[model samples]
Target: MKGRKFSPQKKDRRKAIRSIVEGIVLLTILIVIIRALLPSRGYFPVSEDRNLQTEQGFIAVSYFGVDRTGNKTLISTKRLEEHLKALTASGYVTISQQDIINYYTAGRPLPKKALFLIFEDGRRDTGIFAQKIMEKYNMKATILTYAQNLTLEDSKFLKAKDLKELEKSTFWEFGTNGYRLSYINVFDRHDNFLNQLNTYKFQLVSGYLDRNYNHYLMDYIRDASGIPMETYSQMQERIGWDYNSIEDIYKRELGKVPDMYILMHSNTGQFGSNDKVSAENFKWMQKLFQMNFNREGDSLNTSQASIYDLTRMQPQSYWYTNHLLMRIQDDTGEEVAFVTGDEDRNNSWDTLKGQPEFIKDTIALTSLPGESGLIKLKKNITDSNIEVSVELDGNKAGIQTIYVRADDELEEYLALSIENNVLYVYEKHKGGEKKTIFSLNLELHDGIKPQSLEENKLEAEIKELETELKYVSDVELTKRLNEQLKEKKARRAASVIEGAKEYIPEIGISEAGKRFLKVMLENDEISVIIDNKAVTERLKVSVTEGKGVYLEAAPSKEGYSQRNLTDDVYDGVFKSLVISRYSTEKKDDILYDNRLAGFEKVADTIQKGWDSLINWFIKYL
Candidate 1:
């Protein structure tokens, strides 16, 4: 049977429709191919800004890692974007290794605000998550890799091929952390000797290896007794071997090693914990690389800084954008435009004292060295029994208090204070009388059992003794340390909690991590839960009629270090604060929730997409 023939007009219409569909598909493919082939051209607003000065020196900032979802150490993509956007908006531009070298060596000028951005550890996740942001901002960064990962088949770390591809992307340049990351002469808090541990083994037993653990090159080759076994020349050779290996691997894999090198373990009196070993490491570093990040915390680098000894600040994942700015300004003595993550979220709260800024999904109630910052959630509720569920930054440095049933005058409230790993249940009213209803030292108190506390004390004692014994050269002090260590060891061995499995933290509250906080106020009684475990079964509180949720951050007298240092500010950040009155009125106030309602979110996303589409068509159509 002959196929039915369409009229010429009908065929033309069908052909035109088919051609349009083909054209769209081809256009999309062409755009993608062009994007892949195009070389990235970084936009330096700082250089373009004639009003800004370029005579000032550059500063380096390093991030440990980045991932889709952030952790205590690794930053999330969203936060990374915020950080980069803020820097770019403030007329800061990323500088390359050559740019820095030129600035120092040739007396060439830098941008008004030059940023030598870095992402250390050569993590695949860091590359995956951070690359888009770098591209988005037209920024460039040096991605540090471990030369040891070159030989290994591990996919967790970025391989040499990955590094080369990253270089091709123009957003990334290659650098080396070291040949390997290892520890030596290590005594854990439990007084267990961990001799020469690799990265995997080190992580497996990381909780124990706190202050006692030393960087592999930080000390001479030591025996189990923590005595240096290596001679001066032998120590030099051992240190040189790792550096040589790093050079060899990079040269073999990626043609030549990148110029930048971040020596592991900072805050060691300029370079290394061991002076002689540091001298050797410094010699090797200078010979191998043009620059070395010899220190962390201080990000500023000037012409006066030694090429072999540079510094950069590694921003922890917990840092608010303002916190980052505070640190940078403190370091460089330059005024920085402090960033408030999302100002629109502030409409729900009243800042009672100090500064309260919204930072992404959290509210940073930041305070100065000796100041207290407080903010109240603006919602009217009459329920006496209400629950405040929050995820706190939970720092050991400052006090993070959850005030429930707070009066409008801010005179009376039931406060659950988390300070220096201790939970203080107290009441505040208009009168001068301040009553402590309950107090539990979270460091001593365990969710499982209290026996673990004694065991921890013994281990901590042993750890202290070991540390003293290692540091003290005096015969008398060493003997005393040994005796104390022996007694602690005996106690630990005799303790019944030795074999018990526990996840007891070194510090109950961490400055770098988030802890779940839930406080339930019931008439005259209040209950507290931290990290989903009951902190107190029953905490008696004064009867409060009003249902006002408040947050406070005060300068901690204890817990974090450098207490004597003046002008030190602490920010107590809290995320996802929700107050629910379950029984009576069922009133719920998501005071600081950053998320929109489901339908609203859908509409927002559609609007954004539509705007983007329209803008793109307008630009290129």
Candidate 2:
């Protein structure tokens, strides 16, 4: 039987079905392949819950003590003893800086109450005193020193020897405050910035390596010669000594670290050559610490009891010498507490007392032990009642209080809450008396409640990706490579022109020929155009400008000679003929000629002509 002719529509439908089937098969295979390659959902198990409990407490004693002259200093022996007595009496545990650093770095919890003692400037007296007191109290202190002062003779300053001794002690560690105290001044100068930087490096390395090694060793010791002898030094050099830089430097030096850091600053007594506390310098220091500790103000409270408690990790929360108002709300999002700095002693609380609606409904506490100044309020409501909310007028700087009561009987229903913000008091009545006796809202403030590394292989993968991205996206780098290519081409063009220049004079050429040749030889822009353009009818010549040379070329109307001209004229001809005397030094012909050898001799000559023509074209183009 003869095969039946299929209709066009039927054929098209069959083809479409085939395509769809093939697409479906391909898609299915792709899906399977993707599923096989994709990471499994359960590949990584949940990490064990990290202990996020933050024990909030103040550093009881000031990290730096004030001296007799009102200058900040390390705690004197007498003061240290008194502070320690108070700290211990308050049941606080004193830990060293090393302990803190180690515990924090290891991700271990700190003691309930802990304080860190940090001495700046590396004074001999402070160093000696710190060592003795730390030894006595079994505590730790960090000493920040200017490396330049670490000479052997300057025993009055904590020298290299003292650092060595301190390093051996479990209670102390050393940090750099710069090579000299001149980091600030030197950094500010514009003209000698680079020189001062070099000096800083020399000083830093010299302080570290100078005593042990002589000039010979210093010159050859690559690591020991620069201002950036240490990783921290290099970081500081790059990023400067801003607060972020300091924190980053600390981490680089100490490894994975916590928020606490030992910093140095000038004391009042030892204000160096500068007479007054440099507000700028102090601001820098304050910013640095505030950023690191996440504290609010510069006024550091130095209560020995609080310090001991903070150091030991006791009393989970305590106020900083400076306080901040935080917003508080009940489950229902009602405004219950609103405190302002100005209202701490009067005003806001008194206003609440005068409000008849609040006063009649709330009980005024006359003689509630430890609850006198605070106002108390209470009311009977269902389980779904809105909780109190506390709002602050401004950033609250100090503490405030609140009190709540349930019944009319003064003794029956009483709840007290203290906060800088509004306090939500949840209460339940005991018996069926159902007498709404005492209900008072108290404006009071008390603080309470302690509320709560890296895999190298994974890191390597991330770093590799970053490097690849850098290579792909760097425009400047690509431009630089292109520039190098251009330079090489220019040198090659120059070589061909030099050789052709000698031949041109022998060929009985005209004065115009020499002039054209000279101008091409000098212009860089002429050289680039000569190398880039193609020879064609009308000899569509494009010229640009560079160096001091100008290009002028007369086009030959005769096609045959023009063809011959085309063979001799490439980019090199214009590049070599133009005489550019723009550079201070004379152009080196021999070097250019040698590079031109890389290209065909004929092509090279043509390039020079093209270069010259382009130079002239540029003047007109």
Best by TM-score: 1
Superposing all C-alpha atoms, what RMSD in Å does each candidate have to the true structure?
9.9, 41.8
Reference-based lDDT, each prediction: 0.73, 0.31
Residues 430-487 of candidate 2 have per-residue lDDT tens digits of 4533332222212121222111111222222333333333344578766765565455
Structural similarity to truth (TM-score) of each candidate = 0.72, 0.26
Per-candidate clashes come to: 0, 91
Query: lDDT by residue for model 1 over 1-621, one digit each (tens)?
Result: 999886999989999999999889668656743553345564433454443333568889999898655776798766788788877776678889988777777787777788899999889878776876787888989999989988899888998888988888778888888888887787665656666766666665554555667778778868878688889999889998999999889999999978988888745765677889888888888788988887776788887877667888877676566666766776777777766546677877778775677754578887643578788777665777777777877467678887777788767877778776677887888774667888877655555454454566566556545655655689987887788777778764334355554545544223554577877766677777877788676566665676777889886665432111222456787877777664333656543355455886688688667545543543354
- Least accurate 10 contiguous residues by lDDT in model 1: 559-568
